[model samples]
Target: MSLLLQIETATTSCSVALAKDGVVLGFKQINQRNIHAEVITLFVEELLVSAGLKYDELDAIAVSSGPGSYTGLRIGISTAKGLCFALDKPLIAIETLEAMVYGIINADQSAISADTLLCPMIDARRMEVFTAVFSAGGTKIKPTAAEIIDANSFADLLEINKILFFGDGAEKCREVLGAHRNASFLPDFVNSAVHLTQKALEKFRNKEFEDVAYFEPYYLKDFIAGKKAV
Candidate 1:
């Protein structure tokens, strides 16, 4: 059956899903910042129960390896690694931006042939993002980058066709990117584990599983914790 368990906590949302052979059997998600640590395990348990499965039954665990929230990524990676160790299973890390794109790409029947570009962005901080652009066929047009806001950053990238930018960061940067006539935004898009099902299945078949002992989330920048100035 090739059962896979997937987790995504790369942004404000915390999502988990149970799938068999690339088809989701059950899923749960909550879109609130700072809740990944609080809700991830509960959601995982819920999905397992809904799918009538157990931790030991999963063939592998797949997680969104991030260029998104630093704390959120840590919470997810730690939980996933713990399960991997306990269950004696392989772990798969999918890029956060790529997962976001997958969520958008598979959302509709029209998406398969849409000639527009898909640029998925994650809010890294004020005026910054972890983002990349992909063609309708899922080929990367612009490699993921930790970019600062600018009017012309994507000017050249949009010359070919329109782009659909969506994520936590997309709305914030829409105006700045609006100088390019071909650019548009899709604010409804959010990260989800359902998107990782097929991707994880592909990795599982190709033996691209990851070693859990040393695996870590891809926080695009160093995390810095601070308090308000007194």
Candidate 2:
């Protein structure tokens, strides 16, 4: 009977979902840059109204703890934290890439072979991405890290395994990894809050909650601020 409010602002998607017992009741989202700060709260309120739940009724708030955009993560985590504090509900965090793995697998797309591997990438800068590798069953076979994609990237794995490269960062890799018969790319893939349900539910059941007072997003790489305009 857990009611969870999920938010994902990682990458360019600003999404919100309200779920009951791990099932998405209602959700809304937009894939646009620099709009998270404007629409995240609106999305949450709309979901609450559509789902017939109030802030106080949420059992917990789940947010994507990211290896994604620094600003996007900040907006998402701050919004989730604000609700948790106002409602006195617990906060749960799911890794951005992990939820993404859940997203693609849950899509039930055409047969993913037993030998196929799952990898979700979040755009960083030119040629670099925040990424990880997962088994077909969604187990993390490789740790999350910031990788610079090149012809040799994942060479060993690509030799024997079919790897699916996806997310906002994957499109850029096609030129580098395309010739490999073992590597394939998923186009137009965007992260969504809906994917946070299963893991959030598991964390709620296990009482795995973050300290509301001191939680922070997993920025993966150090954020370097741009130079000030002269």
Candidate 3:
């Protein structure tokens, strides 16, 4: 049986999960900003204890590789990498937006249709988002990109296909795209480590592991630190 420890801090949610054979055993997460560093490892430790598994017992460590928060991504990827090195386990990296697509599918399968497109967004600077489009079946329909939203954003796609816009970045887009008849939103979606399970399992079976010493978070855009008031 394959056992994986998944970590996700690519957004406000700081989450961790343990999965056995592609099924999520359990997860712990808190959807509040700026607390990832303090709680991530603690969450991981608690999870393994709860599941009665040791760090070495884990077949792999999976982390959400992101187009999300710069700080959050660093915290998550660094933690996963540290564990991989220490435990001598292979690391699996899953795209943040892709895992999110699975999250909504698992939660709201009945509401989605084969024709509807899924767009997962991670908030970036004012009006911009790290986003991508996917089919409900989890196929990537569009490559991930950092986009500035406007009334015309996704206008062409909305004309033919219905879309479900969600994640931390969806709210800012509501006023811009929500007016369209074909557009819908999943109001309370939050990133979770459990979302990484499905893809992690796939990558594990395929032996798609990353070079532990060289892997880095996909920050989509360069990070700019804010200067404090003088």
Candidate 4:
């Protein structure tokens, strides 16, 4: 029986889950903005207590490594690393976009056909998002990229494929891509720690652990500090 702790703060959601043998045991999450730093550790503690498992009992600690928020990823990775170091446990890093796709498929597998594609997006800013494309079977078709939404975006693929666009970034994109017959949007599909269960379990079975001391979240872009108002 593999016991794991999962953390996901990749977007505005601060979520934590305890899973044993790929089954979610307990979960706690809040989707308000700017609460990651405040609630992540508390949520972890609560879940551990609720699940009746000690930190050292965990087989591995899984975190959603991001192509999403810079600060959110930092908080989640730092917390996971801290726990891993303290308990001498291996660390598992789940790709943020892949996890989001898993959450979607897990929720409604019937809606996705073999030819349908999954495009998970994370809001970067106005009209821009971090996204990637995956097949219904979870094979990555397009690598993660920062894309500027426009009427012409994904035009070629939409012509040939039925693409399901989701995540926080998908809402803004609906208007821009709505006219395309093959472009479909799944609104309100936020990233969650529950989604990390299966992927983390696979990594644990394959012994795909990261170096606890050096592992960092995949911040696809460099942080740019905002200028002070004069």
Predicted candidate 2 versus true structure: per-residue lDDT over 1-230, tens digit per residue: 89999999989999998889978898899999999999999898888887777788889999999989999999999998998888899999999999999998888756688889999999999999999999998999999999999999999999999999999999999999989999999899989999999999999999999999999999988999999999
Clashing residue pairs in candidate 4 are none
Model 2 RMSD to the real structure?
1.1
Which lDDT value does model 2 have at 122?
A: 95
Q: Model 2, which residues run further than 4 Å from truth?
A: 228-230
Cα lDDT of candidate 3 equals 0.93
- The residue pairs that clash in candidate 3, if any, are none
Name the best candidate (by TM-score).
3
Q: CA lDDT of each candidate?
A: 0.86, 0.93, 0.93, 0.93
TM-score of the candidate numbered 4? Answer: 0.98
Candidate 4 least-lDDT 10 residues = 48-57
Per-prediction TM-score: 0.95, 0.97, 0.98, 0.98
| lDDT string, candidate 4, 110-221, tens digits | 9899999999999998999999999998889899999999999988899999999999999999998988999999877878999999999999999999998888889898
What are the C-alpha RMSDs, in order, of all predicted structures?
1.4, 1.1, 0.8, 1.0
Worst 10 residues of 2 by lDDT: 106-115
For residue 91, model 4's alpha carbon misses the true position, in angstroms, by: 0.4
Error of 1 at 188 (Å): 1.7
TM-score of 3: 0.98
